[model samples]
Target: MTANDTDTDVLIAGGGLAGATLALALARMVPQLRVTVAETFPLASNAEPSSYQPSYDARSTALAWGSKMIYDQLGLWPALAQHAAPIHHIHVSDRGHFGAARLHAAEYRQDALGYVVDNRWMGLCLVRELLKTQVQWLAPAEVTDMTCHGDNVRVTVTTAGETRELSARCLVVADGGRSDLRERLGFQVRHQPYGQNALIANVTTADSHQFSAYERFTDSGPMALLPHGSPTRASHQSALVWTLSDSELKEVLAMPDADKCTRLQKRFGWRLGRFTRIGECNHYPLALTLVDNPVRPGVALVGNAAHSLHPVAGQGFNLALRGLMTLVEQFRLAGEQGSNPGELAVLQRYQQLHRSDRVQTAGFSDSLIQIFGSPLAPLTAARNAGLMGLDLLPAAKRWFAGNAMGLGGRKARIQRPGFDNSKALNHD
Candidate 1:
């Protein structure tokens, strides 16, 4: 069908975590709205290679407390919690330094600081929840072209062997860092490479993790070890994110399995005991990318398409989730007023509402990378002192904990208590 013939209220590009979650959110929040999600990857199957499933990759994600609340609103926590490992405490320290800080969930009166879940499990949960909704899913499809009009967006998508044009009142771009649609729309982005590569692997430790996450800073870069594995399992396993310079990354990637584990134990210290077994290792370049304008007349960008941050604080997805919730609220308001969801004013309002949070979160993540990654002795001392100070000051600790938990700044509609998700968009 031609763009003019096909009817859809919203067309979302990329059915990864962000796109799929947004689709499911709209389906629950605005049942009357027709939402369509186009994904380049096919529905995951046992035969599909791990590399083909971007959303269901082997990586693990740290979901903040606020993100957990969002999932609770979507009725997904019950399922996701089954596979998640709760992080009761976060231990931050500078390797080879005396400064260290510990953040506890009890200090903030919360059950968990965050939860770590395998990306594959999270994706499967999202897809499962999505299947239960009315949102249209077009997998193994790609958007080849897009044209924005005064009132709607025309999208040309290729699925199977046929190309079809579809029209939607709003086009939501959640295609991730290398978003083709974002480029097609000509959105300018400010990209900064950190000149570092992050090596990730699932590692087993001799001692039990005790549900704690660790962020250690070394001369090379920062390293994070997040608790992982099933609750009933006896062995201690954690997802490791080790940042290293290009040369160091190459050296580590080439090391023998036993030698690699020994080197990791030496660098990471004996906090979790000796690094025993490690799963397959993967590495990716690190960069900070932010779109100049995330919203236009008929479009809005969410998730990595809008802002991709360093994983230092694990805030990228949490920030994007908040932005998506804000956008959904704006659309609900517009629908209730019989206004176009893709109107420039509506999109701009959404952008303005989220601008501060986005800026702060991105800045926070970037600052952590720069300040902790610096090798200068003076700056290193300053950071060490900062960590020590955070541990000593209650108010400062509370503020930092709240921000780290994704509860700072203006709360999203989904975060506000008493806001009914089922009745959020009952305009009809």
Candidate 2:
């Protein structure tokens, strides 16, 4: 296969959430550009029984209000709204301390602070929307090698039993945190391990959650419980993210279900009533992985591939969505100007536009983990005071809430326009 074999303007590697969403966004925003997504996992129908994707597994994500806007623009909210649980309030407190802060949706005049959607459901919605677009899908396929040229990128992909070279003006890598493609390209990254693991599970409580979320800073780490499922569901449940040390996590995972629930209740207290039952639990090592530069000639990285942050604030996915919006905007402009999407200038503009948001969001989450995890008496006291001050100060509370809701900073909206084929031109 050569550049003339396939007419893909933008070829995306890794058809997980980010890649799939990007394909869909580009299709909607720049419909004239042909996009192809090559994924390592088989198509849903062709997937083997043992195939399990961590990013799209049993875990759940809290979608901030800003994320909701993106979904609304994509016309996907209606499909996902059914399975999502709205977060009407957020309660932040320090365990065994007097300092606490509460943020209510009513205060911001919004229906909910955020929403909790299971990844499985979210993936289904995205794939369904993707199938309706013109983007070509390649699954059970992996990119073996890639070479960048002045005007295009040549990607060698292995699918089924053959290797083929596909060409595109630009390539978007969303292969995730441990990205082989990124490593092959020699992109430098900064990684910091927190020596913590997040144990996630869905739990049913004796009382209703009323769509409120809780973030409790404990001696071990921060534990968060976000309401899950709709109010009409038969059982009241919430998603639990418990951070524990490596040793503590091993011991907890080895415990029997009954024992695990008991220990969890002891640590979490009676905030949401007794823990009746918990579903299967999964663990993820916590770390901060940041790419020094997320863009290269004819290439761009999104989601975990570019920056993977600790899940303390649940801003990882939300931040990625914002970045995607920015990338789409840049692509749309390039298309109109009939410029090469792979040009260094176009990629640099995206980097400059998104740098501040990435830095601020990553720093905010990292700071929370460090400050709350500190055992020093003075630092603990100061953190406690900070929490109380946030609660008492309306302006400060609003500022904090805005960032948490993903509404702070420059806003990017998806541009919906009729496809203009005349504006789309070949790179070389």
**Estimated TM-score for each candidate:** 0.91, 0.91
Q: For residues 1-428, could you state the per-residue lDDT of candidate 2 as single tens digits?
A: 33344468899999988888888889988898889999998778723222333231267889998888788878888877877788988999889899998998877667788899878777888887888888898988997778975578888999998999888888899999889999998889899999999999988889888898999999999999898877344336888999999999999999998888898998888988898887889889999999979898889988999999888688899889888888888898998898777778898888898888888889889999999999899989999999999999977887788778875544422111453322431111
Off by over 4 Å in 2: 1-6, 46-57, 231-235, 411-428
Quality of model 2 by C-alpha lDDT: 0.83
- Residues 322-423 of candidate 1: C-alpha lDDT, one tens digit per residue: 888888889888989888888899999989988888888888889889998888999989998999999999777777787778865544222224445344
CA lDDT of each prediction against the hidden true structure:
0.83, 0.83
Quickly count the clashes in candidate 1. 0
C-alpha RMSD between model 1 and the true structure: 4.5
In terms of lDDT, the poorest run of 10 residues in model 1 is 47-56
Superposed by TM-score, candidate 1 places the C-alpha of residue 427 at a distance from the truth, in angstroms, of 20
